[model samples]
Target: MSDGARVIVGVSGSLHSLTALHRAAEEARARQAVLVPVLAWTPVGGERNYRARPCPPLLRAWQELAEGRLEQALGQAFGGLPIGLPSQPMVLRGEAAAVLTGLADRPDDLLVVSSGEQGGLRTGLRRALRRSVARQCLKRARCGVLVVPPSTLHEDLRALHRGIDLRELAAA
Candidate 1:
């Protein structure tokens, strides 16, 4: 895709999600597009009865701290770059895939998501949900869907790029 396109990435509190966010930002820079870091959180199975919905002092303080951290991280990631595309963080309230599909209204936009956790009894459940969401997102998104496997992109799990000169590329 061309530079200046919109690339929206989904991130949670997990390290995997953060890795994906970093990769998404890098990809957006390479493509000369704007990076939209979407931090999506769901409030435990959507089971809120809306009892008053008043902000407790502690909760408000915690939320304020969280927002500050997010803004700081966004600034560090996007602002530190010398001459790259713009990146902004957006907080979304919903399932990651559903929100991505819903937000992707233009063909120029690209959605990047982590494949998800692997290996364990609960692995099956995670894979199932990921597959379902991936299918829906790939079909629903107007643009492209980058379903990144955890092993392929994350630092703890990165494969060496074949025939690539990192020093030359960096200088370029």
Candidate 2:
């Protein structure tokens, strides 16, 4: 809302997240706001397991991996950081929803996330067991929330992976 507002987006290196990142960049450019792309990570065996036996070296390695992932996602999304748009990429230790909501606390800030819908029985089952980041952000974020759906290419790839022939579908 204000000229100094920020556009915060969650990036997890997934196709849907990349789509959201691009959309967030577009929004930031349009609104003349700073783009804050955040990547959240948890320990390999969850926080409780890590806390039970904390390994500082492993933790540092994981943190470096998270930073690399954020950089890779940004590179894949825009070849590099978007030109003419101020950007701040962050790697935090937490769940995606909590990290994103916490960063986008300002009322004028805009939070963007992916719909997180993938076409696979295993993925569907996994998602069913957990609330998606987008859903959580929609419920918890104080700022404006924008959920970007997966791109058409992503759906087509999923269909292909499921053995649906695109040529046959196009012919039909």
Best by lDDT: 2
Where's the lowest-lDDT run of ten residues in candidate 2?
A: 117-126
Candidate 1 local lDDT, 2-35, one digit each (tens): 6458888876645556666678877787777888
**What are the Cα lDDT values of the candidates?**
0.65, 0.92
Q: What is the lDDT of residue 6 in candidate 2?
A: 97
TM-score of each: 0.65, 0.94
For 53-110, candidate 2 gives per-residue lDDT tens digits of 9999999999999999999998998888888889999999998899999989998899
Candidate 2 residue pairs that clash: none
Which is the leading candidate under TM-score? Answer: 2
Error of 1 at 12 (Å): 0.5
TM-score: model 2 vs. ground truth = 0.94
Clashing pairs in 1: 3-31, 4-32
